[model samples]
Target: MPGSLHNWYSLSWLDMLAERQSVLSGRIELKRLARLRDMLHAHDGSVTVNLRFGKRDGAWVIVNLECEATLALLCQRCLEPMLHTVAARVELGLVESASMASRLPEDYEPVVLEGDRLMPARLIEDELIVSLPLMPKHAHTSECGSLVRRRDESTGEAWTLDCAPPTSH
Candidate 1:
């Protein structure tokens, strides 16, 4: 599935587990949902989540999700471009409802579906946003070097300064 249409299906718990654990790999494109955009920053990327559904704790259905992807973010410290890997594992309640406020635990955030079908794109987008880093930073350590500069003068003491443009005539 190359586009957003691939996510419009109601996958049964049993249907998800019938396939081999490793065979469920696919890319889901995220559409800009009004509700989601209001809750988090705008996002654009393919969601690569490994899925498995199984019975656990006697009677509940456990949906195990392992997701990995990279998202563009603005660094909080320097306000520069930064790309960070987003990895998360969560078990969600696969229930059908337009509003799941009552079904979810007091502390747990539920990803509810409007209808019987659970849209994979929306689910993944919500998960990614929830898993975002509080502060994003560039992966390369060298990128920080330019931000920190030093000068050593007469007294043999070192002084640190931020790399800023010099004042011109």
Candidate 2:
């Protein structure tokens, strides 16, 4: 059987909160996620998101986004493929424009409504990208292979730098 409209991928943020609508949950293919393109090792997994709409502080329309996924990234320390799990929950006060987003309450981040509606997939992808580490690395440097030694001219001795190569996945 076909899934109901409840499975629809996008909707009007304002309308959803006003009516206290059902949560929107879906998968976004990794290949289709643009912002995270450079970080992914193989573009092989999908991000799953569940968007729940409601009123925050009983006054403002807020969208609670829950996103989860495992992204393949090249470890900065090891320069090898590594798996990183991204799980994030964010609450945003939906607004009409960029300026309005800046004026939202301290507790609520602002997400400007681009048109009348919002694309859950796009939002999910953006949030996941934000959650990734700036420079992804293994938990321990020991996991990194041999450290290259460079000869210091002043001392005429070889020195090993602590950091490894920064690799894209």
User: What is the C-alpha local distance difference test score of each model?
Assistant: 0.56, 0.70
Clashing pairs in 2: 41-169
lDDT by residue (1-169, candidate 2, tens digit) is 1222123333354566446755767777788777787768889878777778787656667778898899988888767667789888888777777877777887888877666456666677778888888898877776654333223454466644546465556
What TM-score, computed on C-alpha atoms, does each candidate reach? 0.55, 0.71
Cα RMSD for candidates in order: 7.2, 8.5
Error of model 2, residue 158, in angstroms: 22
Model 1 lDDT tens row, 80-166: 557667788876655455364465544333446556565655666777777777777666656643333323443355544445556
TM-score, cand. 2: 0.71
- RMSD, candidate 1, Å: 7.2
- Number of the top candidate by TM-score? 2
